[model samples]
Target: MNKIFEESNQVALIVNEFGRFDVDSHIMNQTALSVSMLQGCICCDLQDDLVMQLHQLSKQEVQHVVIEATGIANPIELLSACQDPIISNVYEAPLVITIVDSKRLLQNENTEATETLMDDQIRASHRLILNKIDLLNSDEARQEVIQYVSQLAPYSQIDLAIYGEVKESVKHGQATIDKVNLSTSHPHTHYEVLSYDFTHPISHEQLVQFILNMPDSILRMKGYVQFREFPNEIYLLQYSGGLPALESMGDMKLPTTVVLIGEKLDKPALKNKLELLQFG
Candidate 1:
């Protein structure tokens, strides 16, 4: 999607955990705005920030505003924010696209909970992209996958992709902006969010070990950190889907805070571990 935005010379306003816009000058130059939200589903926890960013973007002479929502986010809840009277006149959620991992969908032991979330995402989308089709061995297998998706999202226009490539026709389809009834409850009501503000710097080694040993239930962990070893540099820490990446942001006046979003998080245990990593 970032590639599409770049090729078409369209501006995007990304909302993510690492405060990526503040750290990367290239991204800042390419994007109209970048704001960081708390580590949770954007639909519930960070809807206000999303709306504020949209309102700000409306003031600019931008042709498009792309919001890159998190994987765990419910698109319906996020789109509901566009109905706000303040921005409804200027903005419209004409389309919602859901991307699915072909490999995951084909897995035999996919949990019931996982299926429920996937179904909700599919039902909400106007279009669906069955990505990573290259993982399947034969056309027959692909057809099976398509059959499963059809059952889940019968109305959505389906597209297949390998290595993230998709047809232009599917990408540029026209959509109608219809108003939807907003719901107060969210699918992630059971999930837990742990947020902490670190006044002192943390030992880099300890931070790495902490992330490496993070509980499997923790779906995402991201925030800004000031490391003792790299006093001059502020690092953005992001961990998702068993992979972690750290990027250096030369310097910033932002708070050294981190937020952990997941299910059934043991808060006391996590807080104790973070306390040990703090540099005295």
Candidate 2:
């Protein structure tokens, strides 16, 4: 059984676990208007039911539905929801983005658990993300991680960004919610998550070397970068087994933070390496 709303100009209804079932739909609509849609991170396990709910809601003149699959939750329901009411000209696809942080990877550091998580994600066949590389100090430590992630999933397009900072921008509406279109010049590999962070700052020459010497263990890297000559913020992405790329997002209000997501990530070594950058 489903409750129907009178059809209006509501283009889409983003499904989120904002309130308990006790609240009425009118209250739900009011709450939804006040909240930012991206603030909610969808748990992977409930992706199915969420998708089904989205479908039911779509029947009321809503044209598209967006669902976030943030963790290891299976995306079958999400995938199925996108396939229904598939028009020849317009195909609705559930954009699946898998987000994992370095803390989770570093919990045991170089253990089977970390490897298992990465392995499971590769097997699932979805989008990739290596978050939180800003915790590290130097590029060498980050490279070690880049090398390892590239070997795990060669087909998935990966992006590295400081999750805590950039993610908030999406949630807070500081930046427009635009589909991030990744370039194909660089092959999909672990190397995309390569970056450099310094408490003080470094020169452009040093930054270039860091990019060139990126290791295979580090898979992705992205965050605010500060250089002496190039006193601008940079968003960096390095991929093992492929070409490295860097882009500029002008200036981000967020602090410098990078994230690395991969298999068998060296946690202690990473933390020890990050400690070196503590001195300002």
Candidate 3:
């Protein structure tokens, strides 16, 4: 993202389930990240939104535009949006970047369906950043993943990154992605999604305990809330893959609604757990 803005003020629409706040901390300049015009269930045409956003930017003489889709988004669908004739006329070819978690891919729990989905995603990348390589214990293990990815994306440049921070810019020289039959409707259908808006301050200690005891089925959660102890400040909560991290959003007034994405969620039970943290 930093690399693109340095060259020009062109736009990059970052589409995440929870919005830019999901990645805002990782970006140095929040202004560069634009909220996606649409989200969740790509059954609708994202291409239209891309065209409209591009036309608006082009009026300002913006030369190029790129898209940053969430981890679970279909790469081929996103690429199609960028190649729409209205956008293609103004910007250069789309760059598809796939960021893979090295440690997670080798885990024993991945289902065959997950593996097949990942293969499609990797093939769509012009540049593959094998992120979290630091999580791998040895150079041999790292090399094993590189070789595995090379087989999947023979045309992509494989690069290493730590915590998703690359030492240099990521450039995908590929002009377009080969369209995959993989459905853009793919990511959300199987997951259970639930959200709750807290009207009062939450107990921090209880919230911490809830996070620690969270089941693996809870895939991702993000929101902002005020703690009873802090009173005046709000914190951003990002929970993923059984880990939770809280950072100060610092009295930035926003909704205290938390959204959870998981499979087979027990909504009643989960709500009971969350109620313990909220003001009684």
> Looking at candidate 2, what is the lDDT of residue 190?
23
Q: Candidate 1 residues 161-239, lDDT tens each?
A: 8655774223332333342222345566656777777888999999889988988777667778898898998888877
TM per candidate: 0.64, 0.38, 0.78
lDDT of 3 by residue, 163-252 (tens): 678754333333345633345545555556678778889999999888888876676787787899999988888875455778887767
What's the distance in Å from true for residue 245, model 2? 31
Q: Residue-wise lDDT of candidate 2 within 28-68, one digit each (tens)?
A: 33423111222222333343455456545645555544443
lDDT (C-alpha) at residue 275 in model 3: 79
The most accurate candidate by TM-score is 3
Q: What is the TM-score ranking, best to worst?
A: 3, 1, 2
What's the true lDDT of residue 8 in model 3?
Answer: 62
Residue 94, candidate 3: Cα error in Å is: 0.3
Candidate 3's TM-score reads 0.78
- Preferred candidate (lDDT higher): 1 or 2: 1
